[model samples]
Target: MSITPRAAEPVDIDKYGPYGRPPSKPPAEARKQTRPGPAFPNRIGTSEYPAEPGRYHLYAGHPCPFSQRVMIVRALKGLEEVLSVSILDPMRDSRGWALREGEGHGLDEVNGFAFLSEAYRASGFEGHYSTPVFWDRTANRIASNDFQHLDTDVATAFDAWATREIDLYPENLRGEIDELNEFLYEKVHNGPYKCGFAPTQEFYDTEVRSLFAALDELDARLADRRYLFGDRITLSDIRLWVTLVRFDAVYVTHFKANLRRIADYPNLWPYARDLYQIDAFRDTTNFDHIKRHYFGTHTWINPSRIVPVGPDLDWEAPHGRETK
Candidate 1:
């Protein structure tokens, strides 16, 4: 028996064009490509996975800031070859995401998935289609979607396969990285998400307060140091960098996370500029994809799904972080 391919329908949900109520459906059920993976459980003792040249694959959607964190860490660690990557379309429908047209994704490059949701199904999950999935391909299933762990896997676990040994997570700076990453996530990473996807005004209000409060603290902190780690870039710096890059692009107008723009923040401006100067950050960033994904796909947020233009920034100019 053959399962006939369903004919593609015009993308009619909404593309964030402007405000319009979505057509009747049940009380809003957040459509996920797959279930969100569980957090890395704390074990009695942990040992780093033995670093190998070719043992893992990183499955990601490029527009995902969480996924970008994993991508940046892999590059900074010089493990591009050690861990192969496959890109899924940032724009997905109810059926879940597939490779963008002519994007030439290897079918389930790790687990041979035609669609990303299959991995979640394979993992026996019934959650959301999340990004930055770490798969142990030889085992033929997802090792984890623990993005924070993704960095640890690349930097600490696969140190043997690392080409340059950049060590984004240095021993002396581990304390600062651990502390700031938590604060940053509360304020910025999931903060914007909570604001945008929030079901009620009260929730959005509280999240908005936390989001800006953290931004103010980060701006003050970065005013003294070159990077968050006091000069050199670290995993923590990279994590914040991905969010800052997207703040103006979609967070401000759409996510309603807009207390202020990155341009308006004093220290944040220079801090972002320094990260933007990095080869990996710039190369991975695409304003088009960033804008299109959130604005175009999340119909509940932006009813019309029309893309907006005009928050142009100056990321390339001289950022005086060195003098700070």
Candidate 2:
């Protein structure tokens, strides 16, 4: 059956005007003319895109954990000068994530594009817009939005140009790292979303249990090691850190993954603090963006949209992990 494209609806100008709401959807004519492009190769040495400094740009938002993961890797690998970044406003509407003018949240300086979706459309993607978008400036197209692969590619693809000598994905530990990362991704990393968005009580109950069980296992694992894989941090640590850092503040209440607050976990709490003390992890985290995006935008979960004001955090306090 052929489906006709519906005309765009009139957006509420007062509530979602130029500054407040996302920019209006692009015209139908423009969308139809969007030329499809090839997906960026998994690695950078392909004929399409090469590993060159100052040639790639990352489009990310602070509130998104997926985006946070990529940003954390970028900072850790010292790719600031090698690759550029543009941050979108924390709040998003139906029009999708916006880079408003003069909001001081950083502009879409790469393509001067208004909405993140526009960048996706330009790259021939017609699906839901997502963050941690890897754009190739030289190719004038998006490289990848598959954040799982995107994170590792950003870490390994530019190793020659990376300013830091940290080996996040070491050759010897690849087997262990991949195994643990897959486990964390299913149970802990995406567990809160499953609980929050579940349409049935039975589903929620099942997921919440799985979530806490994974947390308990992680707490036990961290009891001995400072980092996930012994002393040095790895991709697994970065994957888990993004979810843990946001747990007490947003996931506990908003997502109702409230089996217990992350702060209540003995090992997990201190471990989170230890990661936060790192300049890369701490600098990339924006509490304001994290809180507002979850509490304000998820109107289905928070109808009143009244952002909570408690749960004071002390990430700066001594983690005491050095003694362990």
Candidate 3:
């Protein structure tokens, strides 16, 4: 059930760059523009993209929280064998996320691609080329980059081939999961970016306050339950944990989301550590890549491009969350 490949279209790099705004445009006008990710939104297990082992590959970067969500699900669902992944170098330039040969980053094993943009061109897509890209090796195109539901697809689609029996998106919990996903997406997952890229003081003030308020609310919510949905780790936990893991490391200083550190949160801090103790979450996280990408790459935000040295997070310190 393969679809026709599209012709490559011209890309407007500036629109998809760090801030999603062209240089000539005033920062205030950024809100008016929409630089949603590339439009190859097909899902796995569909008629076009069937659920088959070794047919899909993931193109991801450890630094990106969105990409991390997909990687975490892939690991938790035991799709490492069914779906292969390539880790792009964290540092992105004008050309976009690349696969530099000798730099220890993953080579484009599936398509012999140099830059991720090539995948978009090969898929006949045009726009911001972001990860985690779900490549359809069988069709020689990107199966999906719809970050919103990509993790859910990976969580459910390849169940027959999954090495474990984990179900991150259980049928009865999907309604609750969807509601939490929307709330977290608006206030937590994408909050730091809104605050960091805000054009006006008033805008930053509003966004930053809302961001912290949401964090405070989440802290209170987790005070009793072991997870967002109780005993088991669901997609909601993955969504929130990715943000929490990077909050103190990058978001606090880099994004000016410095009202309080996640370390200071009584419940959320330990909960993040609890997830980190799990191999899937711990293995996919790359602190070096995360720090360097935020401080070194976003030169527009930090002109000096100086990567910071000391937040001294003790991720391995005993969380003692097992009883909860």
Candidate 4:
């Protein structure tokens, strides 16, 4: 059932890097953490320009962990009115990120191009084709292709225009959040990739070890807190959720990060379920999209390219954390 472009190859990582525009909003106005504590490095890349409603359009694929970061922020900040977003077709066939003419793929609602890669070039972004791209229509150029900091932009920069005040990176948690964020990113977030895309066995072994070490540690950490911090969720949760939700569905099976399923971890399971129950994160998750893209696309892993169908997950079951 493996169905991505790399289904025939074991692990065909054609290219690596965050594929998207540079950054649409500039440094000062775009990324300000509402949380009143220590300042975090600008994770989201910034552009040379300013924030303008409707001037920039976001492009993302729900299957992508990085893209989900931005989507979660957009929902939390209530920037649906101030900014626009386009969910691209998950299935891409070389032409890349295009609608199947009618197979649920819509004509480019923003730039009117059939392929997203083309749209990137159309916007003068010749670098990469990764997701969570911010397109600046006015300049006819990519504002910021960096996917990491898109959340920072939506959360703080748009506060003036947004209908609600949802501060994800609150000041009080900044100090602690900073330390945990580093841990999550290095060992958990990008660890699987290091395992999957490593060129040698030694590389894979190192990455897999680091990856699971972080997970085992995180499982222990979650035994006390409902979220990454106290009772409330923040950007820290959003970052880790992107990887955990995809772990059992994609990494466990494909990347071979099979030490333990997110389901196997007691606290982590409930934490993921709690987050999955949220509309913004839930609606953005597509196990099929993630599965097909990884197993099928990374031909280097499963050259046979047969997608599996056995991990029946019931994310809907109530997690008892709410009562705690």
Question: Residue 243 lDDT in model 1?
Answer: 89
Q: Per-residue CA lDDT of candidate 3, range 9-93, in tens?
A: 2222344555233344354554433246548877778998888999888989888888999999989988899888888877766
Q: Between 2 and 3, whose TM-score is larger?
A: 3
- Give lDDT: candidate 4, residue 128: 40
Question: Sorted on TM-score, highest at the top, how do the candidates line up?
Answer: 3, 2, 1, 4
Against the true structure, what is each candidate's TM-score?
A: 0.84, 0.87, 0.90, 0.81
Candidate 2 wrong stretches, greater than 4 Å = 1-41, 45-47, 101-104
Name the TM-score of candidate 3: 0.90
Q: Per-residue error at 72 for model 1, in Å?
A: 0.4
Residue-level lDDT for 10 in candidate 2: 31
lDDT score, candidate 3, position 202 = 81
Q: Give the runs in model 1 whose Cα sits over 4 Å from its true position.
A: 1-49, 102-111
Q: What is the clash count of model 4? A: 31
Worst 10 residues of 4 by lDDT: 3-12
**lDDT per residue as tens, model 1, 79-161:** 78888887776666665655433332333434546666777788777656577776665556666777656665566777766
Give the higher-lDDT candidate: 1 or 4.
Answer: 1
